[model samples]
Target: MSETTPVSELNEAEARAELARLAAQLQRANRLYHAEDAPELSDADYDALKRRNADIESLFPALKRPDSPSDQVGARAADGFSKVSHAVRMMSLGNGFDDDDIADFDRSIRKYLGLSSDAPLSYTAEPKIDGLSLSLRYEKGRLVQAATRGDGEVGENVTANARTVGDIPHDIENAPDIFEVRGEVYMSHADFDDLNARQVASGGKTFANPRNAAAGSLRQLDASITASRPLRFFAYAWGELSAPIAATQMEAIDRLRAFGFQTNDLTRLCPSLSDMLAHYRDIEAQRSTLGYDIDGVVYKVNDLALQARLGFRSTTPRWAIAHKFPAELAWTRLEGIDIQVGRTGALSPVARLHPVTVGGVVVSNATLHNEDYIAGRDAKGGAIRGGKDIRVGDWVQVYRAGDVIPKVADVDLSKRPKDSVPYAFPTKCPECGSDAIREDGDAVRRCTGGLICPAQAVEKLKHFVSRKAFDIEGLGAKQIEMFHGDPVLPINTPADIFTLQNRDASNLARLKNRDGWGETSASNLFAAIDEKRAIELGRLLFALGIRHVGEVGARDLALHYLDWDAMAQAIDAARPAALAQRKADAAEEAERQAAASDNRRARVKEARDAAIANSDVPPAAASAWSDLIGIDGIGTTLGLSLSDAFANPDERRAFDDLRQHLTIVSPDAPASDSPVAGKTVVFTGTLEKMTRAEAKARAEALGAKVSGSVSQKTDLLVAGPGAGSKAKKAADLGIETLDEDSWLQLIGDA
Candidate 1:
């Protein structure tokens, strides 16, 4: 849950944990999308999450999870009809989040091909259709079979539905004996609106978006239902083919067009990197007028030979990348600013704005992010949006980062009201009247009224039962809010939830007679709560909602410690040890910083050891602290957060009390048979055979734990050209060292 932690700051442990979190979240998101034909997460949020996952993988390739998000495609085809096993896999493209990602992509392509920067290269850029993927097969100019991409290798048969799509060619002239055309089945904005209006008139469930509408229409159980919807197909790619259609990407599109398949007219051929970027900008600028949803532009190496050489990753093609756009922007009047406290007590600022149409959606609220954001500064007080502060009655530009959550991108001082006053942020908790404090090195001001703050308590309760946590069916945000303020059955902490039914036993008549409550519903609620009494360790940890101890952190701790008592005992034992270490470290730092003393290193070590010797902290306690933080993915940041939570009397009482009612199940042991599975490895310098990331990934897949720096625990060091101080340290520590070739040989180059 390093949501705010920079990619560069992440260690292997944090990156791995975050990757696991992303895998589970993204998988659920994909299921909501493909299986349900609805988008639960916004496109922008999905891409952002994907980019975060990809970035972490690039940094810590070795820590990539077995269920890595990068390797995942869309959800498997929903169970219905017959499944079609694709002759060739239908792959996704790698994503380029920003201009820098594009640049890196280009660099990576060049490096992979061993070409110079100025080498001859050309690409084809096309609008990446936001729609359902379908593959159509033809035999001797006659349509034969059609299918939807089901998990990449398999798909659902949709030949009957494909015949009804107006844009699909029933028969093609002068075609190969066997040609498979692949493209996206989509609904235009006008068609989607018309369809929704018709559905409304007919009293049917309207689609969420054009993509959903198209997907639902195309995947109908009845072909007659598909024919009624105005669905369009854009054939941008081909699956299996009887013969080679063209030698280049642009030529292939042209061939597909000539074969009567509807192709995107906006597709273009670019001969250089600059052309690719310029075309992307051009497409983005004209996005709204396209009359169809397009998340981004796809760029592919035009040369067919180069593409063949490029091959593919586990899920994506190395030769192609999608350059996604940020959310659309529009001008809106900033009417007001509101502060809302989160479950963790961090106050967030939100803006109330005059409703404005942005990217076909009506937006009235924008995230101010924080107090610093409202004041036009970053975490370091650096200028943002040219240091322009936001105020009430000011005209501002609003945009959705993921086409869902709106944010104020910039302010227009020219339209500011003359009498506008500078707004001052609240210094106290708005809900509980407690002093809100911002600690040093922290960006957010948090409420000090932990249990007393109604906002925090309610939100925390909601989180405890959220889909990612305990997942109690009857307890949702609405229920949490009602129960938090209820006079007869008030829920104030995690413990309250478990003891709710018992507390209400004598008052069952009162509960059953209440508004929105009946005897049956009340019994069901209690049953739901009782069913979760025996919970997994990870779910319990995440349900507690301790700061920085998110889903990934909780899972990692659960995997390492196995049970609640083990983790709690370690947390308890680590506090004094951590304090003693902190004190000793401070004393040594002070000694070292004193004016250039002779034998500075010796004196610093002596000062540290002496401080540790004088302190009452036990060696066993120190070992416990080390072990707690040493768990893979458990770093100093999370370790300290755990200590702080346990150290606080209120959090400890709540956590312990909640545990009293639940049976915590130990996590299953993870067994890996890789040679390096238990060994710690440090990779340094330049790798010739593969990029540093790829090398790390390779080593990690074989069971090695990659570290950023050389340390005492390092069992091996993989060094290449320009091996630096890390290599020297490895040699000094007598750790085994391997060259690129030897390392590859050891792993059998798998």
Candidate 2:
């Protein structure tokens, strides 16, 4: 498209079409740059495209597309890597372009908190390294996992690769039992030069830059390759800490250094915005001589409490921003579009761009979110860019800035090919040819192929064996995929996994003799599988990979049911009752639709309510729906997911088949020796000696069933300061009441 045509000159239809094209183009560029380590445009060109897209979107605010590139942070996780979900989602930082931008950021923060200009707000300024982000998860002072920051919420596990980096500690003394240390994994300029020289001498491919080299080396499937590369790590932030590391950002860095992790020595605490700007300039001046690549300076609010109060925006923290160096830009051609299916059955659209260079990196692909995104429509069906749409054979601008993925910045409409047509989204799953359905309130359409779809099946199996599920010792995503796809040793379902030993025994060919396996390993795997044969009810439920039944929901269900057989029986009985209730409601609705006499409608409604109240549910299942919804944290969404899974005939048969090969262990009841054993208890207000979580854990451990609200079943009430309705309810019921101190004394902790 010609740059001569002003964005304002474009009509509503033209703007909408252009916005759709730009959205698709930019998303493709993101995938290519972030996930594939390739770029098709320079940083400046990409920025220009983005600026143009923003201008049009501003003029036509009602047409802002849902898949706007400005809203996304990173691309989806690439294939061949095991995904790791972060406890605390890793977020991207907002950018500051210049000194004025830094001042604006400071002013914005102060305004958000209603603080005076002279208020003493401290910040920590550190160099923002141009490298890959890695999160090291430690449990009980031992490094358990190391993962790359894939898409904030989920990442790729790279523990083996991370272990090879000398700066990353394998163990830390006096560290919190559960902590996630976040930092940059980078390569020094000297090391990069040396590695490239060695590669040339060996006739191997050489890296274009230190950042790319470090990323490629760290993401290697082979640990030996990562170990051979000279990689260094610097601790900066943390996630999912068991306890507070320090009160301020700088102090937390010191704590990290004390725990044997390397921290940037240049990190400084700035008392004011001017001090932060000065530090940023100093870092910028020394950037070339720092031995490692640095893109900019990051400033974060020092006080942990203040940081917590500031909280987060849509995709970034309000407490911090990354002031990046100027971006580079370039132009490229839109090649084609492709669709990829994810583990969760989401069909993402990808852009194939003519290869170009942006910021010394090559890019060729980008992300296009979904159908609405491609059509210049928002997730809620609003027009984006006045219904602009992207088409093939269009000249697109691309750009990239410090650490951000390359993206399509704009489209040159003047160069658009006449024959190009608006892209049509597929209605059927490309992988399995099943009907692709988009649920209400969901942005992406998903394939309903289930087990019949190879992609969905493999993904489900991976989730089934994930760390939070069955957690089989030797069976990981890679092994599960290999076994499932193997013709001779197929593991198509949960039952198949259990019957593997039998299948192997029946055949002369052994798993032990296979590549990457031995007698001990095979035996150990079988032993692990056997150990999991008597899996806990909670874990079993989670391992089934039921939609919306997360670890917490599974645990709640298990605790309420206690016994496997009893839970299954209740579920079975509740399914029919739920059906009966639905039928009765339908009859009442039909009566109302018929415009029957008021008396007749009233009678129908009464009968419907009575039938629902007296549905055919076993005693244990009579209150199943109510009890499921009543559990603390259990909501209607999760309750429906559980009930639907139980009611589905295919799912029920699958569960029965799996149960035949394994024993589902019942969850243990609360301790019986304590004085409060088997007694339902409720805690109201606040306890001074301990937090609510701690109190609940202690009570459960001491055999008390801690209810959120006081009820007729409650035998004891522990009331602290500000005890209100719950305490009054206990007094009304004549249940025994005790102050916090008195409750502690009764529990033998006074």
Candidate 3:
């Protein structure tokens, strides 16, 4: 009988008995996989068992067992290590989805600290490693025991196998008599590939990915098998200690490395939340390039003193977090594909998906990105990926990548139903009925509709009034959502936001009674909106929803242009060159489109010429279109986007109309001789009195551009608390490190 036999085929007692038996077997298998790195079953067989367990649990929810293999930890422990109890339990972090989730986590942390809403705090960030956890014990400069991080309370012993790994040191000079180090065990991509090849050659089952391979290798019942597989370790935490080692977490990591344990070289110390985000982005950009697999980054407070005060939450630490990367990839159906026009005139392809949950988010749509994404059919006439196309109703895989955007991956041709049909990618904009054209050297199809698209208008308005935009107080997301749907509000554009002042009070008075709002809040919001009738030039530029012009870009534009009128004039004048270049680029792209359109070679030339002459680049307006790129921050891509937006006569008219209603404010210019100007400071180890935010803000006030994650360019590191990985990375890179007091002295605070 198959392990997947349904519970309906057996009596309740038999089902329960089978479940118990399977649960035990699964647990043993998991122990071998996670703790010992030795697996009797293949990856496919293990997955099958796991699936069976999941099915049984779903069928008998009430009879579910607590100690099921599903509940066991993932993969294998670190190599060349011994098990040791954590000085403080190293718990995993909770995850966040959108900015709201992040904000909520921030709020909860503040509440735990008995802080008010505005109380400032600093944070450190690092990538969360996707590997097994292990504990290593050391005795007076000598190696001792290594064990898997079992249930926080008890773990299975694996000291003998751990000793065979080469990266871990057998002894350290002047080490404390007793201490435990904790770290992750993982396989590099190359090692995983080589190990899998060896397994295949030896007539053994191959591993799936590095994570699976490492897990399988670490759990072997026999020590020799583990010794044969290539494994690595990165120490991140300490368990128990005979005596005090480092004064802070950063120092602890240094001590671990000094004792000869392999640790991650990219760990960073982020003194504030903003710096932490920057670090996260840096790590994300390097994710694919990194040799080893990283599920996410781990962040720990640099101040050990603060950490000791805040301590652990239920399962994780209050002073640390695991910022995870996206990983929800599964095969589903690509039911249909459609074109969407954005406010900025960029056209994108959207896939109507057979609803699926990826990375804990329910996704029914995935972005195809551009025209280049469609058309090319695989052998099955489905979407050729890499160079493939997918058809309607084809079973396609989707993944919700780190940025929360979902995209199509592949198709299961054999499972595709006979009724499925080829998907027709639209040749025109769906929102405004404009001709969609593929530009030169471009992979996307853009709508010639420009500013008239309802979809574009609504999205733009939403962005304009967003908290980071004009920050119009009373106009929250719910309110904006209501305004988009209501005929009375008719707030369709940024200009429409100013028109809302003339709206009847009855339309908005109802909001005062809603949740999280009151008369005071509502009135305050209206007041805030009124106050922003005039805004800093940078904020207005960003609020206009210009493509690629984010906060930094806006700041640059403001710095160069000085005011809104100047900025607008520059863009208006540069429209001609932007238009000509776009047309030129479009002519080249049409060739690719022609090949994908059908197999007719003769029609390709004719289509290319005609499309170029009538490309998505609208006609430019004299000198008014030649000055947009004169500003420093404007790039070719942004210039092209702006030119496209203003090229349309209607869009130009709208821009003029919108320009009349707003007033732009100029910020005070900065002076030279600022103390912190041109200096890069990093924070490491522990800080005694001031919060990380205060330190960063003070540095900024003195004109410093504070960056997160130490690098060669990093001038100083302000360390506090459990500043582990970053300190080590900084030291390795020869970056200067500063304790909190030294930082204060350098800044003249002393």
User: Taking the tens digit of each residue's C-alpha lDDT, what string does model 3 give over 92-169?
Assistant: 454543344455666666655545676556555656777777777888877778777665545546777778777877
Better of 1 and 3 by lDDT: 1
**TM-score for predicted model 1 compared with the true structure:** 0.62
TM-score ranking from best to worst? 1, 2, 3
Q: Per model, how many backbone clashes are there? A: 2, 46, 77
Best by lDDT: 1
What local lDDT score does residue 289 receive in model 2, on the 0 to 100 scale? 96
Candidate 1's C-alpha runs over 4 A off are 1-124, 127-236, 241-276, 282-296, 300-330, 357-361, 378-384, 399-402, 437-443, 501-533, 563-636, 671-749
TM-scores of all predicted structures:
0.62, 0.51, 0.48
Candidate 2 lDDT, 488-583, residue by residue in tens: 888887788888888756432478778998888888888898888888898889888777777777876787677777777766656655566555
Residue 172 lDDT in model 3? Answer: 82
lDDT by residue (242-350, candidate 1, tens digit) is: 8899999999999999999899999999988999999999999999999999999999999998888778888999999988887667998999988888777898778
Q: Give lDDT per model, in order.
A: 0.81, 0.77, 0.65
Q: Which candidate has the top score in TM-score?
A: 1
Task: Flag regions of model 3 displaced more than 4 Å.
Answer: 1-171, 174-182, 185-333, 338-367, 377-388, 397-407, 414-421, 485-487, 503-525, 583-633, 674-750
Q: Between prediction 2 and prediction 3, which has the larger lDDT?
A: 2
